[model samples]
Target: GIQVEQSPPDLILQEGANSTLRCNFSDSVNNLQWFHQNPWGQLINLFYIPSGTKQNGRLSATTVATERYSLLYISSSQTTDSGVYFCAVGRSSNTGKLIFGQGTTLQVKP
Candidate 1:
């Protein structure tokens, strides 16, 4: 079993600002994922970083599996970026079942 937690619980940013979000997990995991839940409740896949780092557009993520933690970076925030960011981890790599963190609620003001 794995436990996941997100730091800051909440965040507020102005458009064009930059921010960093963190996720921590207990125990080892074979699959690590990052997602963004929109205000309308749409879950969008952001990243799948079991280990190492990945970058896409204005977003990037890094996972240090050995330390059991991960980080998500958002550069030049926008109003469209307002949502809840989640980190999920799975004990079995092929299994879809995963433990999800409480999520970091982000609000990007215009």
Candidate 2:
């Protein structure tokens, strides 16, 4: 079984500011994904970086499998970024289900 944990339970970022969110896993994982839960509770997939780094627009993510940790970097924050960020990991036995952490709530104020 795999366990996930996220840091900085709460975060406040000014518009245009940059911030990084972190996620740590307890055991080896075959799949890792980052998600943003909007204020309305809609889950949006941000990235699926099992290893290495990836960037899309002002958001990027990096996963170091060897260290069992992952990072989500947000540049140029906006009001729309105000939400809860979650890190999910799936063990080898699971095909599509993910184990999600508590999450990091971000508040981007204008």
Candidate 3:
């Protein structure tokens, strides 16, 4: 079993501003996932980083498996970026049981 926690439970930002969100896990994991829950309540997968760094346009993520933590970086964030970011981890892909972090809520104003 693993525990997950996200920091800065809430965030407010002006359009174009940058932010960094953090996620920590209690134990080692075989895979980690980052998701963005949009305003419409759609959970969109952002990254699946078991370790190392990954990027998707203005967003990037890095996972340090040894430290049991991960970070999501948002650059030049837009209003569309406003959403709840989640971190999930699981022992293995086969288990399909992921532990989710509380989530970081981001609000970007125009």
Candidate 4:
């Protein structure tokens, strides 16, 4: 079994600010993903970085398997970015069952 934890617990920022969220896992995982749970409770996949770096617009993520950790970066934050960010990992590469972290709640004020 694998366990995940997210840091900062909570965050607050103004528009245009930048922030970094962290995720630490207890064991080796074959798959990892970053997700944003919107106010409506919809989980939006942000990244699928299992052992590398990836960027999409104002968001980016990096995972280090050796360190058993991952990071999510948000640049020029906006109110629209406010949500609960989650880090999920799967023990088996092909398994869709994932264990999620406690999540980091971000609040961006306009």
Tens digit of per-residue lDDT, candidate 4, span 1-110: 78899999999999999999999999999899999999999999998888999999999999999999999999999999999999999988885899999999999999
Please provide, for model 1 over 1-110, each residue's C-alpha lDDT reduced to its tens digit, 9 standing for 90 to 100: 67899988999999999999999999999999999999999999999999999999999999999999999999999999999999999988895898999999999999
Candidate 4 worst ten-residue window by lDDT: 89-98
Task: Give candidate 2's TM-score.
Answer: 0.95
lDDT of 3: 0.95
Error of 2 at 103 (Å): 0.3
Give a tens-digit lDDT track for model 3, residues 1-110: 68899999999999999999999999999989999999999999999998999999999999999999999999999999999999999999664998899999999999
The regions of model 3 sitting more than 4 angstroms off are: none
Name the candidate, 2 or 3, with the larger TM-score value.
3
- Off-target runs (Cα >4 Å) in candidate 1 are none
Per-residue error at 13 for model 4, in Å?
0.4
Evaluated at residue 74, the lDDT of candidate 4 is 99
RMSD of 2: 1.3
| Candidates 2 and 4, the one with greater TM-score | 4
TM-score of each: 0.97, 0.95, 0.97, 0.97
Q: Local error of candidate 3 at 82, Å? A: 0.5
Judge candidate 3 at residue 60 and give its lDDT: 97
